[model samples]
Target: MAANGKSRNLESFVKQQLEGAQKRFGDLEQEAGKVFRTLKARSKGQAREVEKLLGQINSDALLENPKVKEFGRKATQVSTDLRKRLDGLQTKAVEAVGVASQAQVKELNRELSRLSKKLDQLLPASVKKVTSRGSRVSAS
Candidate 1:
């Protein structure tokens, strides 16, 4: 009975920790998403402003300028790099929290089920019956 109570308490503690980790992971994901969206919006606004400035200038002259072309290339590269870094940060944060992905959880469940079935097949019916009944009887 004491062992059963201890097991139950342990299970409850583990469940609560898992829940908290999942919640924190979710919050991190949301924060990352918001930051990405904000970055995208700001980039778009800047792009529009650049276009407006180009319209105000001599388009043919500015477009032909090497510096202008270099600036555009650098801006694109920076944006791409920022996005990649943000994605990496999000992935690291999730991993740091020890939260399993859905696919990973499903695969783990499948493996556990397979192992349980194999165990059932190996164990004798009598042993299975006793073990199943024994725990509840002992708890009582």
Candidate 2:
């Protein structure tokens, strides 16, 4: 009879623990759902704002405003200036590193090819035959 009472107490304890865990998980799920809905609502509102702004940008009234036109001009000028500065910095960095720029490399390749062709033309027929027999021949 004592063993039977102890068994009943253990079962009751396990059942209470399971019920507590289920309640906690349910509360967490409800909180997560509420957060997701709030974010979705805010995202929809922002999307509407973006659409309205796009419509305004395309409107003739906004485009014709002097302030807007001035802003556009300033923006273009800033972009151009930034590009020029970047190009200058890139050129300086390339020169400092002693590495050939693209243009210089291209010119060098063209010159090398021309010289190779000239050397091949100048070499005697006998030299080409010797080159094929395992000995390398190169024009100075």
Candidate 1: Cα lDDT at 44: 100
Residue 128's C-alpha lDDT in candidate 1?
A: 52
TM-score, per-candidate, Cα-based:
0.57, 0.37
lDDT (10s digit) by residue, model 1, range 1-140: 34436547866976897898989978887887898899999999999998998788998888889999999899999999999997997678777888877898799779767866776677556545545445522222
Worst 10 residues of 1 by lDDT: 131-140
lDDT of 2 by residue, 18-39 (tens): 5765666566558768988999
User: Which ranges in model 1 have alpha carbons more than 4 Å from their true place?
Assistant: 1-18, 33-52, 101-107, 122-140
Q: Could you tell me the TM-score of candidate 1?
A: 0.57
What is the C-alpha local distance difference test score of candidate 2?
0.73
Q: Rate the local accuracy (lDDT) of all candidates.
A: 0.78, 0.73
Question: Which pairs in model 2 have colliding backbones?
Answer: none
Query: Which window of 10 residues has the lowest lDDT sum in candidate 2?
Result: 1-10
